[model samples]
Target: MSAHSPLPSHELAIRVRALQVGFGTRLVLNNLELDVRRGEVLGFVGGSGTGKSVLARTILGLVQKRAGRVEVFGEDLDQLSKEGHRAMERRWGVLFQHGALFSGLTVLQNVQVPMREYLSLSPILMDELARLKIALVGLKPEAADKYPSELSGGMIKRAALARALALDPELVFLDEPTSGLDPISAAEFDELIKTLQQTLGLTVFMVTHDLDSLYSVCDRVAALADGKVIATGTIEQMLAAEHPWLRTYFHGTRASRLTLARAQSTGA
Candidate 1:
């Protein structure tokens, strides 16, 4: 963040270089490079099995990379000490697909998971903070005591988002956040994400196949194909691209539906 820090002064939240990952005889990501700047939403897209999630997990250290350098917040992940790594991990949040909330834990308890693991706050203070996060994500105060099973799908996503935000992370990674929701619910969630990103000055690295999300929220799009990012740019740039996959994706049937919806919303 500092002018003299090893990281670029312009604020690069995440940097990946020549990243390679393989499973048995197959390589999912090979010689891949990416950069996520601060205070922007980057929608990462790829065909099924093209490794969008794999790329995200590799950057988060959940998946091992066969090769490459991953720098986060001006520090190389592979070069950090154990304590340093722990500290760095605390600076980011993740909302996996399907919400990934703990079924047995109440909403408040779920939100407190990261705080409890990293900080030593008293019960009352932690409870207050957890509730604050819950409300911050647009959940009602009463929802805090409910279990994941009791919440609707949309509420579950909001709860998980609250938990992801509990630690006040500078960056967040969201994978397929709109996957199971109805179109209306998904649109609401997209608006919520956009609001949160602007209000919090948070950088977002999202892996999603949702055309509406990409069109409505993302500042940039990164298209992964054949083991690397083939194109990265705005929606118009993506539409203009000639990459086979990019063309098919941005001009496909699903994208047309979103276009129609946008036109209808604007009364065009």
Candidate 2:
């Protein structure tokens, strides 16, 4: 096997090696290594300030890496020139933590921004594409004209998701997709993600703290600690882990409470 070979049978959508990021002298990500396979939902779970978002931004080329290689879809991010980067960026989409919608733009215009910038389709075509994406995320036709302020939190998230899907990207990055929503809404959003992943055959790299979302939507979970991926595996494997942090993270107080409640209800 070559030095680069790890899980060679799987098609790697994102690969990082010895990834280091720093804001001056303080290192954020320290010699991290990770791989995300094609058409899989890999959930990144870690405590705050563990570099989850930093890792995401580094992959997106929004932040400069101090050292190491980040390859997305087999293209080295560090080597891409400005034009090359933009060209490659068209292949992916990002749904940010707070939806990150332009407060000034209406929902339709927000979804059309990327299509206008990256695609040369005609005006009618762009409108049609925007509307199609909007509808796909379960938004009503009438919602398109409304501003971000007019929509509920769930609607805003769905609108942002619609915009993220506007380009039909093969790889999607979702940062805290279900954050700040009611339980019902969050579950609904998870269902939407699963539906879209199946329907579009997408590869999703999601950073989330929601355990229920992880159990429901993620194929694998990668836990970040000390700027490295400490543990990564299916939910069952993670649950079986004896690592202190892993145990506390997955089967913590809340989880134990839920389990006990279920046991009592079932008399098991």
Residue 70 of model 1 has an lDDT of: 91
lDDT of 1 at 179: 86
- Minimum summed lDDT over a 10-residue window in model 2 is located at 1-10
- Candidate 2 per-residue lDDT, tens place, 65-147, comes to 98999988888887889998888788899998889889999999999999999889999989998999999888999999999
lDDT of 1: 0.89
Shift of residue 139 alpha carbon in model 2, Å: 1.8
| CA displacement after TM-score superposition, residue 155 of candidate 2 (Å) | 1.8
Tens digit of per-residue lDDT, candidate 1, span 1-268:
1111244635899888889999999999999988888899999999998999999899999999999999898799999999999999899999988889999999999999999999999999999999999988778999999999999988898899999898999999999888888998899889988999999999999999999899999998888999988888888888888888888898788787777787898996
> TM-score of each candidate?
0.92, 0.91
Q: Least accurate stretch of 10 residues (summed lDDT) in model 1?
A: 1-10
Model 1 residue runs over 4 Å out of place are 1-10, 260-267
